[model samples]
Target: MIPEQRRDFIYRYVHEKNVASFNELAELMNVSHMTVRRDILALEEEGKVVLINGGIKLNNLLKLELPWREKAELNHDVKRKMGELAAMLIEPGQTIYLDAGTSIFEVAKAVAASNCFNLTVVTNDFSISHYLMDMPHITLYHTGGLVEKRNRSCLGKSAANFLSTINIDVAFISSSSWDLERGMSTPDEGKASVKEMVLQVSKRRVLVSDSSKFGKYAMFHICALSQLTDIICDTALPDDACQTLAAQNLKLHLVSTEREQNHA
Candidate 1:
């Protein structure tokens, strides 16, 4: 296997086992101990694992967020469907805010594919800005601030301040964690600030996230569920959760991944 695949294997293995010895991982991957050691060191640097007593353990505390590329690989099809559904909400000549995260990145891709014209797109994600930059019909703006390289986005006071000056027609916010109790939250305070500002300035505050992020909670609180005007996510979200959202009179768009797969 290639280095990335090998590292992915090691990460999944260690995550499943919780803690594993060098010998155990090396034997499992059928690679030399040296190779396993190198991979472990790399994972350690990424804060996904920790070395201890000739073994490696998943870093429960520090592994709250995955790098952008890694997160993009997860639930890829589901995110795409969510994106396409979100794109349908856009109208030509409207100013929209796309939040930073893989889920929102998929929305950016869908928006590009939909051939929407004369739209002003604002974002903090470098990836999204680059993707939509050359489109003749779209005007793209990036929020400049302290760069969070891992997620390929900008955050902090500078980014939040930039957002405060703009009025957004629709804001498609992304979050790593959310629930009924804490609402939407993030581990990074800077991200929270930016998202909060987007919600405050936007006319339609829509949240674009996946089913997997539904029950989770992060360290920093952004806003409550009632703050959102709409939520677009995969249909795999739980029934009870759907009922709760309905009770709040929030518009919920649940994209069907299975239907998309069948159409594909």
Candidate 2:
């Protein structure tokens, strides 16, 4: 395999396992021990991993971002609640923008199922467009630009420029991580640009995320909680964080898993 592909494999393997032994990596890659050691040293210089006794551990500071596929499998139940609640907030004949993320994807699904006719849905996510495209009542506009295969979305200046020209009633945005201090953040600058542009152009901005996303910040800053019109998250958010959001006067919508189960 090429160097980038090899490093990506090693990164994913170590990230999934949290820590990996030198022997394990060498065997997995069918490479010599020295070759594996060299690769590990290289990753260390990039601040992606740390060498320990006989193994390497992922850099905790740099572990803030997970690929979209891995992230989609997490917090499914919480995302469902957030999605359902966000869908209820929308009215018929409204133009909406669904930002690229798993939680926002759920919102797209919810909007589609609501049978809301003459709805204009704009998205950069291939999954969301695919989900709503066939519905006759919904008009879908996908922003095309540089494609990030892992996130399965388009980003960069072209996508952001397209969003700027349109009038969005509400935009459902999400990120790889968020913190009270850094606000919303993502690993990719291109993705951050698209999200920032969406927030700037939308009439009402709704941040749809899970509680676990709190207290984590990534490489690029999207926007602070205070900038959002509404924040929708699961109830697992800490009391302190809730207080912070309240202090900022941001509209906070917390969904309870228990309530959803009971209602079901």
Candidate 3:
């Protein structure tokens, strides 16, 4: 197997077993111990696993969603660049859906700052709705349901039902955790249902996320990678990860982060 495939195997193996020894993994994959070690190191760098005593284990941190304020602060710059790239896909007269998340909030911010006008913005995020509320040129609609105050979003059967009725020109979706194997996922089924509905009703589906979210998994699956038409992320996304997306024929945009541009 190629390196990417090997790493994916190691990831799944560890995830299933909860913890895996280097010797057992190397034997199971029929690869050398050094090869398994190298793959484990790569996975660790992605924050998907943690090195243990002569073994590796799935990172438990990936299973929980961080609070909104914390997530907003985690990768502020990278999310801004990704949001800028995602916002460029919006047109003046089209209706769009912005999924509830900090990354999608940046997209709303960029759209509000841009020249686009007469656009209708639909969202479940309280923060996004409030951010775009004062813009007279744009029409806004909120998916009202159960308030998930932790993420500052609305979710439930009512929220998902509200999304099913509207046709979206483009939908910018966000995720706390995603990977090649599992696609986009979240810790709550409510969030997953809303996102799943958005994917089904939109003409164009775009995933706006930072590279940090890659190589991670959550408790609930939203949708598979094949469901998306485009993906916007920072250049810190690994080359092999990019190749995996490219091979699937997804439109991938790797924007340069502010830090990278400033250093250049």
Candidate 4:
């Protein structure tokens, strides 16, 4: 398997099994103990685990990771609000750049509801593209690239080249992790390149992330925290985080996390 695919498999296995030892992984992937150790070391460097005596344990204090689908489910209410707020920023007869992440896809769903006339939506995410295909009122543009099955997204050189050619009114993106030090990040270099493209095309940029993203850093850097135009997060965040973002000269929006049923 390719290195990226191998790493992704290791991540999926570790997160699913709560692995206790390198031996377990070695047996599961049909690899040797030393190979398993190398995989664990790689994951550990990305802040995914803590090695211990002859074993490994996921650090409870470390960032939480969910499957692509499960992540979309976790903060549905907040994401919807974030999506609405992102869409509200849209102007008719303008073009936007959409990065492929759950939060950004939520923004597309919200935008689809609005069906803003004469607005162009450009993206590399298959799920978001399919979502907008039926919405005739909004013009949709897609980039060609190899598809990622889990997230149903596209990436690589072609997509990057496509993004380079278009200037956009706004770009709404999601993050794997965020911290003042490393800024916004992702585990995959391929996706990070796509994000770089989003930044390149956007005249104005917005980052749509949740509370879970704050105080964390991921593998690949897309851009520095100061580069963000605004950050939209849920109200459940701490004051210190809000202060930190403001200190970076970033506008912040706090959306309600509670579902409508609970609000009622």
Candidate 5:
């Protein structure tokens, strides 16, 4: 099919479902996943639909995107709620850690919006640091390391080593995938180990994730649900998974669906 035809199909599919996954679009247009992805990329450049995790959704033009990758788009709603809950745990003057994830950006937003000024934030995500820059009272410390362009974060042995030295009050982590039976995991081994180090130095390790992470596994395992002191998530999470975490004595903080979020 021609590119014009494919573009039309993309619009049609998105209009019908409000979301279109790469695989679904490929099937509809009888093309390859790479073709679909390329089309989505072109569309994104054209200011059309926003390409998310294997999918596309109508763009929210008003909000300037904060260097988000496709990997972070799967559970957008769940991430917002988790961010709110994570923010509530932060107290004034506390030292906190925020990992590089879309959900974690929400945590950054919540913290920045609050009046509390006596907190130090350590982060590897450039966007998170950028978001907190205007907030006068928050002290920002970045992990000095090689920057990963796709995720827009610092990751390397240097970054991991830097995190090992800092003792923090609480660390809010985000992951791409999780397995209750196995552990929390991520696609990049270097970044996964960075998360592990962040948890090690923090007094309270809070896992902030969405329901889409459940039942999935990544190449590198970070930490187990058992290792987390608590988890914050939205209502889309499965009850069975929650029960599994509970059996491991992990405290689960379920966020209310009604909590307001800064939508994308």
Candidate 6:
């Protein structure tokens, strides 16, 4: 398997099992113990896993947030497809709020690439602001606040104050984890505050996430799933998840990828 896929498989396995021995991982992955150690080291470096005595475990700390670059790489294709689907909801001359997240970054990219112009975009993410700098027709507003380096996003009181002032037509929000029980959550309190404010101010709130995010919980809770106007996810999302969202009367937009289409 490719390195990314291998790493993701390891992550999912460890996450599901909560803990795994070196021998077990090596056997499950069909690789040597050395290869398992190497993959475990990579995941350790990413803060997603912790190496214990002869075993590995998911970080499991509710407040541990992975680095933005690391997460951006985890589900790259799924995120891009979700981004494209999210951009379809945007119209011309609208005021938009883009939350600070790697998944939301894809949405910003799709918006930047589209024919939609003369739009005012407000964001707490420095990278997203920088990405739209060359797009002449877009008016970009940055939420000046404390930076959370791991996520490369702005947060704290200054960001919240700025967000409260603006009226957003559509807000694209992302979270580290979500489920029927926890709703939406993030590790950072400041980021959660900013996201909650954006949801309140926007006329429509759309959540952009991949299937991997399901059945997880974070430290800070934002809002329940029913609050969102819509959610964009790939076809890899489980049927039970779809059923849960549907039961809540929430709109879940399923975007099919080429591989999923072929299988169908």
CA-lDDT, candidates in order: 0.87, 0.84, 0.88, 0.78, 0.77, 0.84
Query: Which has the higher lDDT value, candidate number 4 or candidate number 6?
Result: 6
In TM-score terms, candidate 2 sits at 0.78
lDDT tens digits, residue span 1-264, model 4? 555665666766554344567777677678778777887788788777778888776543335455568567656677888999999888889899878878888899888888578889899888899888988788889987878777778887878888899989998888857777778877777888988888877888999988766666656778997887988888767888788887777788888767534787
TM-score between model 1 and native = 0.79
Per-residue lDDT over 69-157 for candidate 5, one digit per residue giving the tens place of the 0 to 100 score = 54454455666667777888888999999998888998998888877678999999998998888788899999979888878899879
Per-model TM-score versus the true fold: 0.79, 0.78, 0.78, 0.75, 0.74, 0.81
Off by over 4 Å in 5: 1-67, 71-74, 256-264
What does each candidate score in C-alpha RMSD?
5.2, 5.0, 10.0, 6.5, 8.1, 5.0
Error of 3 at 262 (Å): 5.2
The model with the greatest TM-score is 6
Model 1 alpha-carbon miss at residue 70, Å: 0.3
Return the number of clashes found in candidate 4. Answer: 0
Tens digits of per-residue lDDT, candidate 1, 207-235, equal 99887677767678899999999999888
**Over 4 Å off, model 1:** 1-63, 258-264
| Backbone clash count, each prediction separately | 0, 0, 0, 0, 1, 0
**Model 6 poorest ten-residue lDDT run:** 60-69
Encode model 3's per-residue lDDT on 28-89: one tens digit a residue: 98999999989999889888789999999878557556567767766687788888888889
After TM-score superposition, the amount by which residue 57's alpha carbon in candidate 3 deviates from its true location, in angstroms, is 9.3
